[model samples]
Each structure stands twice: as C-alpha cells, then as structure tokens.
Target: MTTELTDAELLDAFHRQIRLSGREDEPAPGIVRDTDGPVARRYPQEPGTSYCMIESPRGLGDDPDHWIRRQVDFFTGRGEEVEWKTYSYDEPADLTERLARAGFVAEDREALLLGEVEGLIHDVELPPGVQLRQVDSDHDLGRVDELMRTIWGPGRDDGALTREMRADPEALDVVVVEESPEGPVLCAAWLRYSPGTDFASMWGGSTLPQWRRKGLYRATVAYRAQLARDRGFRFMRLDTTPDSRPILTRLGLRHVADTTPYVLDARRGA
Candidate 1:
C-alpha cells in the first residue's frame, strides 16, 4: 500500500520545510506587519509604491469586500498607492472583482510555485572565472543593488535597499556570481526565509543580456537551494514570469496555483 498526499497536505508539508530552515526570517526591503484585522501586512516598495498581503478570510465571518476596502483606505490615507496580491485559494469569492469595482485594476496572473529544496539542489559547473559569493558587507550590498538595476531596469531607489540590508543582516542572504576580467556581472538574490511560513522565496534573479543562456542563473539557484538545505529548510517557493517557467520546471518546482495582483492607484485622484 502506498501513502497518498492531498493538496492541502502537500502545501502544509512544503510550508513546514521552509519554516524549519529558518529562511523565512529573511528581511523584506520595507516594513512588514502581522497585525489584527483583515490586513495581514504591508510591504512598501518605495515612496509611493506599496503592496498588501491579506489574511485569507475563509472563516471568522469576515467580509472580503469590506476587508479590502479597509485596506485601500489604510494605504490611501497614508498617501501610498496600493497593490493587492490575491492567491487562487483566497476566500470570500469575487474578491478581485470587488477590488476592480473599487478602482483596483487586475494585473496578469502568475504561478505560485512550490518545490522541495532537496529536489532543486544539484551540482552545477560555472564558466571559468565566474564565482558565487554570499554578500556580507555594505559594499557587497551596493554591488548587488547595481546588478539588480542593470538586470531588471531601474525605478525604485537603492537607498531603501541599502537600509533594509543594513538593518537586518540575517533577513537577507544575497548570492552573486561575478564574471571576471572586466566587471561584476550576473547577480541574484533570495529571501532565505519567510516569517510564519515554511517558504524561502527567490527574488531579483536577473542576468545581463550578455550573460544569457549561460549556466550562471542555474548555478545561483542551486547555490540558494543548497543554502536552504544546509539550514534544514524543506521547501522553496517563487512567483515567476513566463520566461522563468521552463527553468523552474527543470528544477522540479511544481505550479501549485495562480497569483494575481489588483492595484488601486490612489494617486490618480490625488
């Protein structure tokens, strides 16, 4: 006889794995909150850019529309524009529609993928002179920021990134792969851990156009996976674009559900 795992069981198992590794403690770039009420937390990306993660109001007689409107009011009162990320499992059905009615626009859907760190870790070879290092100092953090701007295209201020990295050294574990001979090239970063969940998220994995198709990206991912495993984390999770879907699939991550963001630009009326 074979034991079978239900979807909920699989999700819970993955969560436990990430929590044990302590990677969930990785510091986010902005303020994080775990409070009472419908709004779980707010992540401020920059001066005017913010996002909210709501507690799924599956029970407790909570009204999704009411809770969402409260969140909008919370951010707008502070003069911050808000983006609300909703997962497929979110309850109080038609939450997205409610957000739209409240002036929040629907964004493209992306996969909320989960996988075991054990499955993702693999020995991969890097090109000659390309080295992977864990960032530790202010200078390393600055370099990581520069690399991120180069790969992802610039917008947000780097000052916020610097402040977050300095405030909580343990909150972030930035891994970089620098190419020799000219300058540092191709960099990636991951939130080693998440608070209250067993999931370490991969973020800011960008490669310069010149470095495309090389194994640098894969190596960076593997390095992070190994780090998670070393810390005893069981699961790794990420929200990815279509470009990264194939690469993640090769690493054994499975698509668990879709995540969509609804945005309310409070600035429009301001």
Candidate 2:
C-alpha cells in the first residue's frame, strides 16, 4: 500500500528524522543564534555574502521588528550584503515590508518539501546504457565540476567549488549517470547528512536539455534517496522550483511552504 502522509505529519516526521541523522551539526557556531525575542540569528555560507535565517516568532517574548533591525545592523556592520530566507507559514508581521524598507530586494519564492527517505528511494528503471557512478577522486571531482558548468552555465571559480567539496565530503555526494551516445547527460548532488538533524538535502539537480523527461532525473532521485536511507536519514528535504514541483510531488514529498531569499546590495547605497 502507498504510504502517503499529510503535509504536517510528513514535516514533523521529516524533522524527527533529521534529528536522528545528526546532519544538523553542519552549520558553524555563530551560524545559528537566538535573538532576545521571537527572532533568531543565522550566518552566511561564506564571509562575502550575508545570509541569515529567521525562525517562527510564535510566542516569543520580544518585538519581531526590533529583533530584525538588530539582525540587519549586525550583518550590515560587517560591510557585507545581507540575505534572509523567509518561509510562507512564517508570521509576516511586516517582515517582508520591513526588509524592503531596508533596501532588500525580494527574489522568487521556492517550494519547501519534506518526505520520508524511503518514500523517494524505490526501484526504478534506468535508460539502457545509462550508468550510475559515485565520484571519489580528484578526477571525478573535476568531471563533476565540468558537468555542472556544462549543464548550468559557467563562471564558477575552481577554488570556491573545491573548498565546498572539501569542507563537507560526507554531507555532499556527487552522483552522475552516463549515457553512451549522448555522453554523460545527468548530474546532481545532495547533502547526505545534517549534523543535528535527521534531514538530507538534495542540491544541484541539473540535467542537460536533450535528456529531459527521459526518466533520468527520477532515477537519480531514487538513487540518492536510497543512499540517504542507507545512511539512516529519516527525512529528505529540497527546495523546488515550479519545473521540478510536479516530479517531487509524484515522489510523495509534500509541500511544507514556500521560501524566498531577499538580498540587500550594500555597495549600492553604502
């Protein structure tokens, strides 16, 4: 029987799984902080860009607006541009308006999905001659990098990609499927584990144009979900654009909410 679940139930289950997987430890020390009120603090992926996380302020003791201003000043003081990810279910409290007032540009929102690892990792048929492989060495890394650039466009510096790859080998797995006549046409990667969470996040699901709708993407999803299940992850999470939403929904991932990243260009008005 199919094990479909409600969005809330799936999200709760997914969160529980994340706790069990121990993947939540990936964030740095100051990357996640608690503010005086319903607001929390978060850091960026690197020093150059300012990225922050704001959690639900339900029942928190302080003013959310005041806390947000504090967060803005905290990152702005560092002479860096700031980005904040806000979820659909989050109490608006004029947060987006406040952000706009502070010169933050709002970007498109993406769907936040959560599902059980097993729900995604089912048996799948692969296209004939398409071979799946795990990347391990420098050569493999280079190949993965090349595939990323080829499928997604160029301009990624080698140093940055290498640094990212090195920092979280366990968390990041680059998997690819190669087809003979078309060459290697499918490429994707996932964050296999989160330190304190039972969640594994899938990223970089880029497929070449000629290979679209060929079942390659679904197979890759199953492959990674199996890997995550084997690693004991309970939940699988991904941010999806409209193009991929149908695929994920078919895979049994329920939409938790939508998320948007708002960025402020410090150089423009500083």
Candidate 3:
C-alpha cells in the first residue's frame, strides 16, 4: 500500500502526526486546545519552560493577542519559562507580532523541512579519517553533551538532550560522527519517532566549529533518513538552522514552513 502523497498531503500528514502527537511521545497527554489553543506542555516543570503549539493560528480564534496572553499566564503562573513557537504559515500571519508584544523574546527562526525516506542517499563517505555509527552508550552521550557544553558554553544545559533520552532508548536513534575511534567527537545528531505515525523528526544535528564545510553533516542526515526508511517510516521532518537549511533544501526536502521560538525566561523576567 505504497500510496504517494501530494505536498499538501505531506504537510497535512505532518500536522496530524506532529502537531497532534503529544510532544513526541512524552507522557504528556492529548493536545491542549482549551482557552489557549492547542499546545503540548512539558511535565515535571523546571525553572524555565517551553511547549509546542499543536496547530496553526489563522482561524484558531479572532484575537491572537488575547489567546497568547492566556497561554503566557498558563506558563507564567507556574513560574516556568515560556517559549511560544510560531510558524510562518500559521493562520493570523501576525501571530509573531502577538508573541513579541506578549514579552516573549524571539529566538532563531528555522526552516521546517519534510522528506520522503525511501532511497535517500546515505552511502556518502565521511572525510578521510572519520567514521560514522549509531550509538546509545552513556559514554557517547556524555561525550556529546560535553561537546555541546563547549559549543554552547558552560551555561547551556541539556534540555533537548535530557536524561530522558538515556532513560528511554527506544524513543531515540542517535548518530555521532567522530574523527577517530578514540579521538574527540566531531559531531552528533539524533532522531525520534512517534509510535503510530508516518513521521520521524531529526534533532540536534550540529558539527563542531572547525568541522563545518565538510560532508559529515550531510552524511549524518542521510544516515538518519535511511535508518528511518529501513524501519518503515514514510517521511522525515527536521527544523533546521540557516547553515543546514540550504543543505537540506539541496537534498530535495520541501520547505514546508518556518518556526521561531519566543521565550519568556523565568530567571530573566524575575
């Protein structure tokens, strides 16, 4: 039953599975579309907080400002940091304005990409001395996290690469590219799958500062795509920074939408 889907169908499929999929398999329950519109909040809240919006806002309601306030109050009341994500294609195109006006600082804007997984090119070789492989060991996790600390500096914590991933291996397929078996880590990337959907989203695809301009990043993308394809996933989605967006675009992925994170850090607001 290999039914091919149109671009609109792929975009719709993305929303149906992701925007509706309970925050990528976290214990979080159904989509939150109550007074605040559809969102999926993180549980066991920390000092700072962020949640994903489950749907577009065009027709979500007549007044996005009012809706955004409610959403902000929901997070602020609990003293959690808030990151209200907005998409370029979201309804009420001015949702970005509403988010900014609500006192949420705009973070990086990225291209949302979707690609079919079948026959993706993964045979590309790494640089002469590098090797790529899948790993889930604590050693690898620590090494990669340390690299993140270096790149992002000592202050950047591990929210995205949290202990949850180590606690739940079935939820992640991580791939790291190393300059050598025992050498310093060059780069690492990971992918996560939704249990009952055609989508698997890639995350944390970053290279060390000096490792850019090489083919390792592209190889990592192909590696993850083929891994998902082999596991029966039909489509691959990734939110990319400008550096990777062009590469992903060249790989035949569709530029479906763009998302910017609007953050309300509890620490700063205090």
Candidate 4:
C-alpha cells in the first residue's frame, strides 16, 4: 500500500525533486542547459527563450542581492529576454522586490498546484457531443496552435511550440476536446512528463468562450491524469491561474506555493 503524503511533504518533494533539480526533461535541438550557477538555467538558441529556474537564494550565501543584480545584467546585456521564475517560499524574503529593483517586471502570479494521480484518476462525464483525444500530427498541432491563439490572443506564436513538439513528441501528450472525431477543437490541453521524475505538468486547458462551464475543462484534466498515472507518474502539477484555482481545488489539487515570472526584456531598449 502506498502511503499518502501531506501537502507540505508534497510541496517539498516538488521543490527538491523537480524545481531545483537538474534537467531531466530533454532540451530541444540548439537549447543549452546551464547549471553553473546556484539555479538551473535553460538558454534556448533564440532570444526571448532563455530562462532561469530558481527555487531559492540560499545557495548564493549571504549576498543574494548582488547575485540578483548580476543575473539581471547577464541576461539583459545579451539582448535576450529571460524569465526568472520565483516561488513564494523561496529564501531571503524580499526576493520579488529585489527582482523589481533590478529591472525585472513581475507577471501574473500563479498557484503551484499538486495532486495525487491515484486521487485524480476518475471518470469525468463529458457533455453531449464533446470528446477528448490525444493529438500529434503536424496538421493537428497546427489546429492546436490556432485554438490557443483564439483563447490567449492573436499575438501568440506557434513556432516555438511546434519546434518543441517535433524535438521530443513522446515527452508530451497534446489532448483536445471536440464535437466529433477530427471536428472543431472546443477545448484543448497537454501533459508534459518530466523524465525520471514522479510528476507530470498540465498545460493549456483553455476552452472556446462558448464552451465554458460544461465540464470540458475537468474532462481534459481527468483525461490527462489518467494518462499520467498509466505512465508511472505519481503526481500531477499545474501552474494554475486564479480562474482555474477553485476548480482545481475541488478536484483535490493543493495549492502548495505561488510562482511569478519576472521578465527582463533587454530587446526593448536595444
């Protein structure tokens, strides 16, 4: 019998085994994984793709302030826009303010939600005429991109997304809900499995405006959760917006921590 972990324990495991851990997920071609500093960094071949995953500043000893400034200058000097992901429980307190002082603009804060796969693997009854299925073809992926643009905005690009999908398609499961097989995509989402980790992260569950509140979101979630469990992962993680927090909470995901991205767009003044 598997022992249940408390939310605190789950959060700690997530930080130690996933957030602060070295890269286990495969990088796309031309993407470099840099671990020379106190944090894990991913420097993609293109500008605006580089980012740092920092779980805490304790690794920087007593002068995290200096480290923060140096990091900001490092990325900004390269004319590359980089995102520094920070967590609420990250050490040295005032870390958010420090990023702000160093010219990093804060973005929306999201709840880092965690849920057990066993608890989440339940059947969700979809509304009439809607169904969920995994997609992978270039044509299907292009449709997924269009659906995302409709949900997020027209300015979003699918180049980076399609590139990542082509690099390692097995690492992700892109699922969509439609009126019928190969029909109009009413809702869509994807599950990314981090190799060698016990977790799979959920992304992109946006439904078309007309399809909201009819259980499409929950159905996609349950669909992904089932896939994650079948693949030997024990937990599911989501960086959830406020709108999805209450629904996820009802589905047994605990809000373990808050995460905000601080972006340094060096290209702005260049």
Best by lDDT: 4
TM-score for each model: 0.82, 0.78, 0.85, 0.91
Deviation of model 3 at 2, angstroms = 4.2
Could you tell me which 10 consecutive residues in candidate 1 have the lowest summed lDDT?
18-27
Write down the lDDT that model 4 would get: 0.78
| Candidate 3 residue-wise lDDT, 1-270, digit = tens | 577777778888887777755444344222233323544444344433334332343334666676666767766676756566677777677777767787888888988888787635556777887899997777777777877787777543454455656556677888899976567779888888776788888888778989888888888889998888877888988888887888887887888888787787554557
Question: Any idea how many clashes model 4 has?
Answer: 0
115-233 per-residue lDDT for model 4 (tens digits): 79777766788887677888887877777888888778764236545777888888888898998656668998988888788989898898998999988898888889989999999
Q: Give candidate 1 misplaced runs (Cα > 4 Å).
A: 1-7, 13-36, 43-62, 195-197, 268-270
- Tell me the deviation in Å of residue 41 in model 4: 1.9
Report how far off residue 240 is in candidate 2 (Å).
0.6
Considering lDDT, which of the candidate structures 1 and 3 is the better prediction for this target? 3
What ranking emerges by lDDT with the best candidate at the front?
A: 4, 3, 1, 2
Per-residue lDDT for 119-168 in model 1, tens only? Answer: 78888888787888776766766777777777666755564556766777
| Candidate closer to the true structure by lDDT (higher is better), 3 or 4 | 4
Error of 1 at 88 (Å): 0.8
Report the C-alpha displacement of residue 59, candidate 3, in angstroms: 5.5
Q: Which residues of candidate 2, in runs, are more than 4 Å off?
A: 1-5, 13-25, 28-46, 49-61, 154-161, 180-185, 268-270
The runs of at least 3 residues in candidate 4 whose Cα sits more than 4 Å from the true structure, single-residue gaps closed, are 23-26, 49-59, 155-157, 181-183
lDDT by candidate, in order shown: 0.67, 0.66, 0.71, 0.78
Error of 1 at 109 (Å): 1.6
| TM-score (C-alpha) between model 3 and the true structure | 0.85
lDDT (Cα) of model 2: 0.66
